[model samples]
Target: MHELTNETQGARYSPTSIRATWDGTGSVKDASRALGFSRAKGYDLVRRGEFPCRVLRIGRSTRVVTASLLRVLESGEPEYSGGHTGHCTS
Candidate 1:
């Protein structure tokens, strides 16, 4: 995971530029960047079942499949209105 800093606030955040790879593997950090989401918000999306990306669990680790994430981004599906607390905000 990479830590990006907000220039003005000087607070460290994650990168927001999502670069798709040919191998179809994605990191949570990258996905968060692509979606303009905070790390906590990204995990919240997963818990709310709003993220369409497929996750692979290994032990206590989770991995997202890049292709699936890209598909969701391109599908024009409903926005993730299931707010961070698992309540639908739409």
Candidate 2:
């Protein structure tokens, strides 16, 4: 595992660390951690089709595309902006 740093304060993942740690695809949990969010929140994002990167649903398994993750991290922007329009219950 590689250590991800938020040196830039707003940076979600360390591009270098991600590049060194993942090649093809990574778990939503791991991607969420890299994005500074909880695992449950990650699943929620996926469930609502609001994940920042490309997500693949294979059978009952969900995978986050490593390249898309890297691209988002490197570019400092989300590929998808499916923001919630519903009221926040939290």
Candidate 3:
């Protein structure tokens, strides 16, 4: 497999664009863009436990589950809205 570089993902830190290379999981930065958040805001949300999804700490890094993200997308539900009562963050 070809390794990913900034050029391949486009614009180096293009969060939205980086989703293409992600499979089962992705970083907070990538999920932030997918969820329409700025990087700082994403980290803040993670800290507050209000990121609209689970943020798992794996050793020295964090990641978001891509399957859960897809569930939200396929359901067409609004994320991070106060109306969220169907799901809980763990």
| lDDT on C-alpha atoms for all candidate structures | 0.53, 0.77, 0.63
TM-scores of the candidates are 0.53, 0.71, 0.59
Candidate 1 Cα misplacement greater than 4 A, ranges: 1-22, 78-90
User: Cα lDDT of model 2 overall?
Assistant: 0.77
Cα-based lDDT at residue 77, candidate 3: 60
For model 3 the TM-score comes to 0.59
Model 2 per-residue lDDT at 8: 50
Q: Residue 66 CA error for candidate 3 (Å)?
A: 0.6
Which 10 successive residues of model 2 have the least lDDT summed?
A: 1-10
Residue 28 lDDT (model 3): 84
The prediction achieving the highest lDDT against the true structure is 2
Query: How well is each residue in 59-90 modelled by candidate 1, as lDDT tens digits?
Result: 66756666566656667453432323554333
**What lDDT score goes with residue 38 in model 3?**
83
Model 2 lDDT per residue over 1-90, tens place:
133434553343577777776868889998988887889999999998889988778778989999988887778788653453552323
Q: Arrange candidates, best lDDT first.
A: 2, 3, 1
Count of clashes in candidate 1: 1
